[model samples]
Target: MDITIEDKFHASCFTLKKEDILKFDKEDNGPINNVLIGIEHHCYGVRFFDDRHGLSVEMFYINGKGLLKGDIIQLQVRDPQYYQLLLRFCVLLADDYKEVNALIAFNTFQNKLRGFLEKRGIFTVTSLELRQFKGQSAVMVSPSPRGIVKIDFINQKEFYVDFFNKIANKPIEKGKEHVYLMVNNDTGLIKIGRSNNPVYRERTLHSKEPSVHRIAMWCCEQNIEKKLHIIFKDKRIRGEWFRLSLADLIEIEKFMDSV
Candidate 1:
């Protein structure tokens, strides 16, 4: 059996109704995918679902971040290659679920897959997956275990640029630093920071058990994150976290997009 790992997730916008944006107006909250990880999850991990030989495929989804929250990371194991399977699932969703409420169906499928993987000693990440009480009294948490691994931004430099360029549908100057926005959906608190490893920072926040939904990440070398922090200091909740309205989000969006 031949297998390949996609180095990066395709960072693209998902379509949703205006009603959705209003409902989820907690500042650029994810924008929705087919059968998403959670109600406000930003990162959507999509890949194959095999029946012949169940391979080890894992991605971190902590509540409103990747998958769902809790000890179990609920997600859909979809094989888009199999149109029949997708069609069957869609039909089932429409027939069984109310108004094709895909969350129930997709969650079921993902949970079932997780069960299968568990039985086979394969693991994807949930909130509690990386946590462990070691030895006497220390609690050690790994943000990206092998199961829910982090993207290597340094090594795969070109891929990063290419992915962003594709998202913009225009060429971007390869940047030396990245400024990102992460939101805590539960509290409606947003974090604006600069980090080379934004994903790692996100998972670290996940360890604290906030619904961290990654809003957007932009590559820039300047101290823009700092500048934004100072600009929005009045709106600051604490530290890097700011209480931003949708309009403020748009302003920040304009700034990031400019870079």
Candidate 2:
């Protein structure tokens, strides 16, 4: 199956130029940038990134064909942090077929993803949006701090469930300030920032289109937060948001504790 179309994709990912990838489908939400792709043998591997390196998912395997007869599409997620996101996305492709060899259920997972990223006004969570929008449910997707996180939105629930599940340190007692890491559901960016009140900052950033939720917080001074910015300057995509991975995030938390 031909995974990529000539004009469909902007260009090869060697340049790491976001403009190289066509963004006709989505203008804001449900978009990706700086994609790196490769193929080894029959395996198609890709890395999706934001601005920061840590926030990216690399070596995502979209198997070319099935095991024996080129049937049963396979999606392999190597990154531990993004397993939930990949799993959820792959589930949809799986649902449409019991066993499809010709197109391997949908040409390939890459096609499904390219369509999701490039198509205009296509809701990956069709059923969820149908119920929410048609039902006139204005209830925005809110991420819970603890306990079982109710699935509100696709990306929203993934980060909360995966990132907040650990609940690293206890909540910031009842006192001082702290640097916070907020996750944006739509853009897939993590904001490493601070505020007099992290909760208030989160409220200011929260929204329906591009949802923002504070996933982690550290009890540290503003200076310490600045230190983090310097340390991860390479990952800094913009002001406070950094393309951070799970390990990078963990290291930030540990640094906060040490300081």
Candidate 3:
């Protein structure tokens, strides 16, 4: 588990790829491994995955502008000592789940472990697993009766803002808005599209053509829970509409199937 740690002042020193870029695409799921230069410095790395297209990773803090370079960059994994300690701690807590004193031990260890995972890009699960539990506590660490709890992204600051905006339906404005959205409560294919005039089109058009309903239907037929949420996207530009590709839909279905 010993992993190398790379340190440099600029991103030119690191490699970037479609796999890495997808991994860091903040639009789908907040990238995993918000790697920082040091304990206090900003994150230089993030990870993304697309089962259909493959993985994409990115370095968000490359010399400040956040540009992707073609050079190959190595990700630092957790050290053997750290991982062993974590696995042992998890085993202990799992064994003591019913004990009253377990709460104290669990909280202490869980916090420490979470920080450890975030630091080294080694969580109890992958970004997919983390996203499955986006707002609630980790089921692996902290069991829940519902079994379907939102992931706890308190540490992932980006998650909260998008969650809030979706709940509020606050005007996303007319621009190039990047959104990773899902539909759960509604029992049909949920359409995902962007409208240059969202106010007129989304509000007025209800024909269901080119809608996400088809995607939702496929998920439903497969017995997938339709829990939809939006991930963030860049909106610097405006007045263009985009819809999820059929291939992307297939990827979504696969992600749903795994969960």
Backbone clash pairs for candidate 1 read 61-67, 63-68
The most accurate candidate by TM-score is: 2
Local error of candidate 3 at residue 205 (angstroms): 9.8
TM-score of model 2 vs. true structure:
0.43
Return whichever of 1 and 3 wins on lDDT. Answer: 1
Determine the backbone clash count of candidate 2: 9
Query: What is the number of residue pairs that collide in model 3?
Result: 37
Give the worst 10-residue stretch by lDDT in candidate 2.
Answer: 68-77
Report the C-alpha lDDT of model 3 over 60-172, residue by residue, as the tens digit: 32211233322222222232233333333323332322221212332333343344444444434434356657788644643432222111212211222242333314444
CA lDDT of each prediction against the hidden true structure: 0.46, 0.46, 0.32
lDDT score of model 2?
0.46
Q: Which ten residues in a row have the lowest lDDT in candidate 1?
A: 149-158
Q: TM-score order of candidates, best first? A: 2, 1, 3
